[model samples]
Target: MKPSHAIQGKTSEIKLLIESYGFVSPAIFGSTASGTDLDGSDLDILAIIPAGMRGKISLFDIQHLEAELEALTGVVVDFNVENSMPDHLRPPIEREKVML
Candidate 1:
């Protein structure tokens, strides 16, 4: 799919995944976040899973999330999962992920 379509589709899927995972934090950051630039970019989503969910998370689960999102939207979505983040650290990471 085209990058812009991928960005929009991935952003929507990320939001739904966050909700399904029961994240209460009002600010989940993805490609649509302020200061995030999507020109020639891949999807970068920063999600704060619930506090008690800290170390219990799995990379496989994240991979599955990405796969599910891709299947639903026909867009490849990537994510970075963190737990109990302080309000300040959220934006920068989502905006400036290294594409390597």
Candidate 2:
């Protein structure tokens, strides 16, 4: 099923936020992918920011992101920030993500 308008709006906000941080990989995971469900679901965002931006993101920034997402999409949004991850861990997590 296609994602609801709320989910799509949140995704767009997240994209803009990621862009503001200079992330260009286009490898973002979660609801943007096919088969995602919108109702009663949260967003999962994973991106690799520049070295200088690492460890600089604070809890307040995350809270702000969440708030912005809620304001724009009217659904709860969650963010996970990481510098990198093991290759083997990516697929399983992405595959098992609960979008519905």
Clashing residue pair totals per candidate (backbone < 3 A)? 0, 0
What are the TM-scores, per candidate, against the unseen true structure? 0.54, 0.61
| Per-residue alpha-carbon lDDT of candidate 2 for residues 23-75, written as tens digits (9 for 90 to 100) | 43423346645446556766555555677776776667767766775666666
Top-TM-score structure, candidate number: 2
How big is the positional error of residue 59 in model 1, measured in Å on the Cα after superposition?
1.7
TM-score, predicted candidate 1 vs. hidden true structure: 0.54
Model 2, residue 28: displacement in angstroms? 5.1
Inter-residue clash pairs, candidate 1:
none
